[model samples]
Target: MRIAVAGSTGLVGSQVVAVAKAAGHSVVGLAREDGVDLTSPVGLDERLAGVEALVDVTQSPTIDIEAVKFFETVAANLGDAATSAGVSRTVLLSIIGVDRVPQYDYYVAKVAQERTHRVHSPGLHVLRAAQFLDFPGMAIRWGRDGDTTTVDDLLSQPVAVGEIARVLVELATGERDDDVIELAGPRQERIVDLARRLVAHSGEHLTVIARDVPEPMRNGALLPGSGAIIAGPTFDEWLSRQPA
Candidate 1:
């Protein structure tokens, strides 16, 4: 199977490429360095020839108000090209809880992408994955000056990025199911505790203050439902394996 992965140099897409190759598939990397940009498909049709499927894991460069518009623009560019390429299947990575709530602008854009794929590619396999274990470090400054670090008591099931990439290859090549697949970590964790563990792993000191977070991110809202698949070396397990 010849699979082209957009954003092939990114955190998720890179892993998808490695996994796809490990699973005995030829990969076409769709990135600027690869001489192909999905945002402007000038010669994309020529490149996508004989490609079976495409996995879109392109991410917004920023985490601000403008990211919503940026996401929509990127999705439109890639979705239209993928549909035109006559690919058999298309897989897109999405977030959990965004489809129903759409509380954040970025979340709304994700839903829009899924909807567009639904109309364009009938065999769109949507993988609504949970937050990544590496997300905590990116969330806030925790132990910069060895002081009390404040964090939300938001509960979430975060999976390893490598694990998510593994499943993406499975979905992209295994079958052409159009249904949404929910994926999450095996155990649920709170932000404060997760922060504390992360700091400890780095041999740092900081008092963790767990404050109340907003709705739809608390309790079991971010956890996967009964039918959702649970795949992991768990969050704590994954953290322990990280380099100090």
Candidate 2:
């Protein structure tokens, strides 16, 4: 099967490419680093020529209106390009609770992306996964304040990025299901605690301050629903595997 993966260089995208290749599938990795601008759709139509499936894992670092617009645009453009190219299925990596709660610009953008996928391509599979274990590390880096402060009080059920990629590969090759599947880690932990643990494991002594953030920014909408599927290695297990 020929699969096109957007954001193929990202934390999740790289894993998707690896798993798909390991499964003996041909993959077209699309990312800005690779000269494929998903936000523009310039070469997408041609690039998706023989693609049987498309897994979109594109993301932006900014959590603002521009990010939302970028996702919406990319989804719309990619959905249109895939549909026109006669792609059988397009799988989108989304987050849980995007629709139930309207907090945070990123969630709002994700909802828009989902809507675009549905409208532009009925043969779409939306997979919503919880935060990945590496997310805490990302937060630590992003929220670092000269080694003084970091974001805390947030909650997360972070799965391994590899596990999420495996699930995506499975979904891409299986029967087309125009449905949304929710995936999460085995356990939920406070973001602050997780960050602290990661820091301690790294031989760093950084204090994480747990502050009350807005419900939206706290990813209140990202919490998995009752029927959501939980999978993969637990946070503790993943943490233990990290290099000291």
Candidate 3:
């Protein structure tokens, strides 16, 4: 099968491309680095020519209305071009808690993205995934203020990015009855705790503090349902491999 991956160099998309290619599939990379921008994209149909499956793992750099516009445009562009190119399968990567966090701007944007895809690509399959295991590191880096780092006191089932990528590739080529699938890590964990552990592991002279967030996230809104597929390198297992 020939697969085209949008955001082909991103965290998850890159992995998806690697997995597909390693399995002996041909790949067409659609990304800005390759002179293909999904938003205001040119020659998208040409790029997707002969692509049997397409995986959208594109990301927005912002979280406000701008983010909403970014996703909406990208989804629409990809859907139309894929349809024109006769792509058989389309898979979109989404966050697990997007529907649960109605008030959050980024979540709202994601919902809009999904809505656009559903409209333009009727056969789209969405893979809603839990927070990535490396999220704690990102949080700490973003929350840094002097020697203190503040993180949301949120519950999360942090799945490995590689595992998420593997499943996405499978969905692109395999048959499934459902339009949506949820995936998560093996265990539930606190984001703040993970941040503290990460700080300790890195020997960083920083204080990790847990701050309050909305009740939904603090409670369990981001968790996957019983039907969700669980995959690993549990957080600790993934962390152990990180260099100090």
Candidate 4:
């Protein structure tokens, strides 16, 4: 089987490449560094030619409205081109509970991506994955004071990036679909707690402050719903494996 992985240079996408190759599939890497501009879709048709499946794990550069446009455009261009090229299936890696959290900038765009792609490719398989175990580390970017970090507490079931990649490959080679599959970690934990642990583990002296965030973050909006598939490695287990 031949599979094309979008955002192939990313953390999750790179794992998909490795996993697919190990599983004996011919992998096509799509990335800006590889001369594939997903935003513009130049030479994209030629790239999709003879490709059996396309797994999109593309992410935006910014966390604002640009993310929405990025997903929308990529969804339209990729789905249309892939269909024209006779690509059998389209697989997407999305946020698990994005729809319930409209106040978020990125989550809004993800929902749009899902809707836009299905119109062009009816065989799109949407995998709504949970947060990555390393997500807490991202809190540092929210803005860090001299010796304190404001990490909002949110209910999250974080999965390992490798586990997400494994599931992505299984969806790509197996079948076509209009279904949404939810992927989550072994258990749930507080985002602030994870952030504090990461800071201590990394030997940071910053004092972690749990600040009140928007209602969207405080509620269980980002957590997986009922019937969600639980993937491997609890947060503690995953963190333990990472280098200190």
Scored by TM-score, the top model is: 3
Q: Better model by lDDT, 1 or 3?
A: 3
Task: Kindly report which residue stretches of model 3 are placed more than 4 angstroms away from their true locations once superposed.
Answer: 175-177
lDDT of 1: 0.77
What is the lDDT of every predicted structure here?
0.77, 0.82, 0.91, 0.86
lDDT of 2 by residue, 1-244 (tens): 9999989999899999999999899999889888888879777889989899999999976777668788878888898889888898889999866676565667778888888888885378888988888888887887888765576466667778887898888888875363788888888777878888888898987877776755753655567777777886888888898899
Model 2 stretches astray by more than 4 angstroms = 175-178, 216-221
**Model 4, 24: alpha-carbon shift in Å?**
0.5
For 101-131, candidate 1 gives per-residue lDDT tens digits of 5565667677777776777662688898988
TM-score per candidate, in order? 0.88, 0.93, 0.97, 0.94
Candidate 3 whole-model C-alpha lDDT, 0 to 1: 0.91
- Angstrom error of the Cα, residue 7, model 1: value is 1.5
Name the 10 consecutive residues with the lowest summed lDDT in model 3.
Answer: 170-179
- Name the top lDDT candidate: 3
TM-score winner between candidates 1 and 2? 2
How do the residues 1-244 of candidate 3 rate in per-residue lDDT, one tens digit apiece? 9999999999998999999999999999999898997897579999999999889999998867789999999999999998998998889999988899887788889999999999886368999999999899999988899999999898999999999998998889884545899999999999999999999999989999898877898899999998999999899999999999
State each candidate's clash count.
0, 0, 0, 0
* Alpha carbon deviation, residue 159, candidate 2 (Å): 0.8
Best-to-worst lDDT order:
3, 4, 2, 1
Q: For all the candidates, what are their Cα RMSDs to the real structure? A: 2.5, 1.9, 1.2, 1.7
